[model samples]
Target chain A: MYRYDEFDHAFVSARVEQFKDQVERRLAGELTEEQFRPLRLMNGVYLQLHAYMLRVAIPYGTLSGRQMHKLAHIARRYDRGYGHFTTRQNIQYNWPALSDMPAVLDELASVEMHALQTSGNCIRNVTADHFAGAAADEAADPRPYAEILRQWSSMHPEFSYLPRKFKIAVTGADRDRAAIQVHDIGLHLKKNEAGELGFAVYIGGGQGRTPMVAKKIRDFLPIEDLLTYTTAIVRVYNLNGRRDNKYKARIKILVHETGTEEITRQVETEWQAIKDTDLKMPQQDVDAIDNYFRMPNLPQRPEGWSQLAAARKADASFARWVDQNVTPHKNPDYGVVTISLKPIGGIPGDATDAQMDLVADIAEKFSNDEIRVSHEQNLVLPHVAIADLRIVYDLLLTDGLATANAGLITDIIACPGLDYCALANARSIPVAQRISERFGKPERQADIGELKIKISGCINACGHHHVGHIGILGVEKKGEELYQISLGGSGDEICTIGDITGRGFSSEEIVDAVETIVDRYLLVRTDKEENFLATYRRLGAAPFKDALYNETANAA
Target chain B: MSVKVLTANRLTDGEAVWLGANGDWLDHIDGALVARHAEAVAALEEAGKAAIKSNLVIDVNVIDVEERGTNLYPLRLRERIRQLGPTIRLDLGKQAEKTSANAA
Candidate 1:
């Protein structure tokens, strides 16, 4: 948890006042919609179907209990009693009034949070692994680097007005939980044989109308040159990326049009010139940022091992939850607990104001005062003691947050589709709901095992359908919602764009189509141990495609 | 010809509203002014522009509707959702308010 220094406090307070003035001017009819839209968007406000939506950033998916409580307060006061946690680890309030935005921002600033780069053609909220510092296999904590990038890129004069919105993700672990491969810039923090910290830099990875796996431009860049190398890549894209078509404006499109080799060469040439500049991070500065993220003091809790074993033995439901939602932590006694936002047939990633408050309370009391919003649209208690798992689980169960299907079929990722988004051609939440209900059984979900079903309303791919193990993209065909299924897509270490199965399914047929794919994988998988992704990779898209289209063909 | 209705989100609160026959914005689309012919459609579009200029609304558009019995139903799903709120959450949006109002 990085506390806001006097500078950060002053800077955020100033921005809030500035936005407040701008809002007043707009409401007073001093600025037209065209003139005010970009300003509103810069403050993370967007006019949606029914009302304005506000996106609040959670830098590197990290939050303190106080900040979580503040988010709950915002939901209760300014919005409908809930907020949607997005795939990029940001929370969006769907029904905030335009008149309430200034006050909402002021409230956020009080909590050391701002919606600044959550939108617009600038470096957006830099995401990192949800389990960054606590994960067992991490090389080093990536948030320190992410924080450094946030400091450097926040209102960076040179990169603010790039061709399109840019996203960067960093992961310290080899597991790639942050989905670094699918971002504009993906930094893999690691140490070389000489024990010097550096990064494996990836460029031009994005998911939209065109999905691209980032090309690894540098084998290893010294940690000191993080900002310099980043500036070089962005500068190259900012200069050459197409501004003619909004669709072709992302760095991913530029990387596609210009060959990877040439783009890498251009970035390298630019880097060579700026390598010795002030952009190079000094060691003391890095250490200063790193100091903010030092691991929390955890005295040995030896009694927790025996207590956890006893608790697991007493309750099968608790055991199931622990098995599904808990992952190993750096400390043997501690575990990273994922609080499932996806209950049976519930909206994915939505938490009620009460739930948010409850989570905040639990985080403060049981876990360290830390909470994380995972990119999978779940919340994380990064340092919950194994001994305290039962108490936390019970509190969560009261609010229907203790679903034992973390990586299962029901743990879906869905975007706010035609339901709320003016840009959406079809509805995504309903499709996700139907699929979750269809496969809501715990035993069934366990049997299916680790299948990600991500849904997007349109090709904007906000739901990240391109990376779902079973991706369902909703598109309007002939005035009806048609869901296009893509199999074998994954946003992981070995990332690949999903293959489109065949003719899309109508809204009525989509759930059955997804079931058919799951059932087909179940039938064809080598064993229960083989997940849907492994089976899909093993036997390409043909079998699942047959199951989807052949069944439709027979029905027709 | 398909009937048309002028719709926009109110600038102050961003509540979805439809242009009424009395030259006023109505939160519910039931009382919206319908345009069945080219001339009326032109009038509706003009009103939308006027509303935008007046700074009363944003994202103004004239959407196609089908006259079903005595009611107007939007042709596009997006517009329908806008009128009725999100389909997924029946407890939310205009649909819930309408339900409660009718019940009352």
Candidate 2:
């Protein structure tokens, strides 16, 4: 929870006023669409299919109760009473009118939030592990560094107009919940042997038409040289990245063309010159940012252990929910509760205005006013006491938020494909919905185990389909929707791009096709203990591909 | 040649609309002015450009359509989804309004 100082408040307010003036000019026909497009995109406003979309950044997916309440208010007032939480840990309003964008931004600025850099060719919202502060296994909270990077990159003159949109992710844990491997720059925060914090830096990773796992450029970059080293890497790409073709514009393409060793050498050379400059972070500045994120004082709640056991014993439903949706917190007395946005047959990552309001209330009362938007498209109550789990669960159940299917087959991640996106070739929501419903049964899903099904509308990979245990990509072919399935992909410590199974399936055949892979996986897996990803890795694509296409091939 | 119609999202609100026979934008594609021949298609394209210049619309295009019975259907799924709201959410877009209108 980084509070905005006077400078931060003034900066955001100034941007809002500037955007308001621009909006007025555009509405008055003083500027053409072409002239206004880039300006609007910089402010996170885009002309989507049915209406304009406003993407608000939730920096490192952190939010306060007041900010969440304000978001709900905006959704109720300016939008259609709901917002879609995207894979990048941002929230997008689908039906905000272009005329109302200025007012909407004004409301956002009131909270310590804005839509700046959510779109455009600037460094996008820097994402980190959702369980940054609360996770049991983290080396250090990554958000402090993320905030530092945010401060450094916000309106930075040199890197603003890169060849393409850039994304950076950080994770303090070895688990890689932030999907750092698929971003333009991935930073793994860790403590070396001497107990001094540093980062293992990976560069040129991206997911789009061409999905690439980032190359580890630096094994241990000192924490003091974070900004200077990052500038060096981005400087190298900015100079050499292709602007000739938009498809070939990302740093991943440049990295592919230039060998990793040469690129690393270039970055190190650049870093040597600038590492001693003002970009070098001082110890006091790092501590200043870290001070903002210090953990809340928690009096030992020893009674919660017995209380939680009693609650679990009383309700089988609650027991199942706790098993699935809750994860271990840094403090033994507390548990991190994931509010499943993916209800059976419901839209993934969508929270209605009422639902958002309810979550705010729950956060304020029980969870110390902290809420997190997971990159997996779920909300997190990061510091709920183990004893208060039942109460939080009950409040969430009232709003249909307590589905208890985290990391299960039904816990899907999807992009707003043809439904809202003008860039989409086919619909992703319906396909996700159908698959969720097919695997809706809890026992069935538990039997299938931890299977991630990520769907993208197009090859942009906004849905992170490239890293799904079972990835479904929808494309347009001969005026009809065709879904191409890719299996064995994962976004973890051992990140790997999925391999396509075979020919694509039509919309009608897609759900069944997914079911075929799951069923095949069930048959091949040694036991229930082995997850879909583990099974897929153990036995390659041959079995799944045979399950998906062999019957059709034989019939033909 | 397949039938065609000029369409765009209104500049102010970004609501999807189509050019009607009366040189006005209609919210629903049912009332859109269809171009059967090359001359009519050219006319529609000109109207689209004029609409953009007038700041009435953005992202103007002439998309293919076919008449099935009295209903107009877009040839491409993208345009079809645009003409009607998202297929997944029946309660959203123009389809919901149309349903309510028919019910009334």
Candidate 3:
């Protein structure tokens, strides 16, 4: 994990002090709500439906044991006894008192964590694949570059107040776990024919009222030019992005309106002016960052294989968890263990303070004290010994974290819908919960195969519902809460927005509708290996649409 | 024909609060002052002034409510959810506390 230096410490502490003063002034009635709203928002404070929500950035989803413990402490001491890990790999405390926000931030700063740039129309927290360093297929760890971007984008004077909130996702792996194709600026760290590091840039992708897959602006951008290239992109966006309408203010809108060819021309023009200036990253600095992210001296444990195999053979459920939750690591002895936050019939992404502390303890013990928060709303022990997998599973099971539902139907991504959000038109968690319960059977989930069900309570698509294989969007019609089902949305290398199959269903009917769609997928699939997205793509929406609307209606 | 009540999240703690008949902000939705037509507008104005003077809440607005027997209920599902905790987790937030308290 990256440690904060003196400059980073000073910058965060000063920011906390500034926000402290702002909160004090607002509480003392010196600053009115109109005056305080933006200031509070800049510090990641949002006035939600029931409480002031404090969103703390978990930079690149990397966490130390100490930092994780502090988060648990904050959840217990300052706000509600739990926190929600969002799709952006950040944790949100749903019930923090406005008066106590400064203190909360102070606690965050102590652990090199902060709420800065987690929100607002600025570069939000840069997200990466949770298994950054450990993933077997990765050419490089993306965290260092993400950290570099975080430093550059933190309070960037020019881009602070942009056309709209900008999001950047970086991934070093080929499978694109970071969902790079759905970001405003997606950087894929790759190598040239000479084995020189560079980025494959995808720009203009976003999910909201209007969802679009990003188009590639640059197939190969030299790694040394990361900063200059990014600056050029933002500068072009700042100059040309829409500001007249908030709805059409994102860079995706600009890319859609201006056409990729024109935008590329503008970015290139801007890049020519500033590519070789002070903005260019020195090769030495890049090497130093690479050194910081050097693979730890994990002594080779060849015995782990036999030990793990023995344990798997001993316990059937442990074997199942190993199959589902444990991902292959670059090291044969090590495995990336995904700790599922989605307990069966429980709220997705929610971790109570006790559960968080337990995870921290486990991370400290077995994962080299390093934890990663996945964008899918789960925690990851990025490097756990294969031999220690069973022990970790047992510990996680005690805290309800070992659901063995990674990539399973129960592992649903849901936004804080009408439950806590001020803008949500419908409740997302209840629908997710009902679906989870309906398909809670392990045998059924395994039979159904890999399915992604994403739910967003509103059109903002915070849940990335647009990219779900089975997307559920909540909308209000005729004073009733209804859910619209969309099929075949994906956020992987092949990015596509789900198509609305039919009319909306009432909250009571949405889960059954989802089951119907999944059941149809299971029936019509070429093989068990054919996942929901592939099956949907092959058959198109006609079959799923028939199952959802026509057959359901006929049955009704 | 819509009965309404003024509500806001308290500025200090961001808890949901309702404008009471005695011009005080109460945590409970049942204590909210119900009004019709002109009274609703005046109540909202009063709520705004209270919000400014006390710095008690932010985003003050009127929500439609209806009388269901002796108790008043918010008409829209959004407002109803705001008044209660998340419908999914019945054991959490203020709704659970309220339920346990009522049971006691």
Could you tell me every candidate's TM-score relative to the true structure?
Answer: 0.99, 0.99, 0.98
CA error at residue A553 for candidate 2, angstroms: 8.3
Give the 10-residue window scoring lowest on summed lDDT in candidate 1 chain A.
A547-556
Model number with the top DockQ: 2
Q: After superposing candidate 2 on the true structure, give the runs of residues whose Cα lies further than 4 Å from its correct spot.
A: A552-556
TM value for model 3: 0.98
The residue-level lDDT of candidate 1 at A401 comes to: 92
Across residues A233-259, which tens digit of lDDT does each residue of candidate 3 receive?
A: 999999889899999999999999999
Spell out the clash pairs found in candidate 2.
Answer: none
Tens digit per residue, CA lDDT, model 1, A172-265: 9889999999999999999899998999999889999999999998878999999999999999999999999999999999888999999999
What is the fnat of model 3 with respect to the true interface contacts? 0.89
Model 1, DockQ value?
0.87
**Ten-residue segment with the worst summed lDDT in candidate 1 chain B?**
B1-10
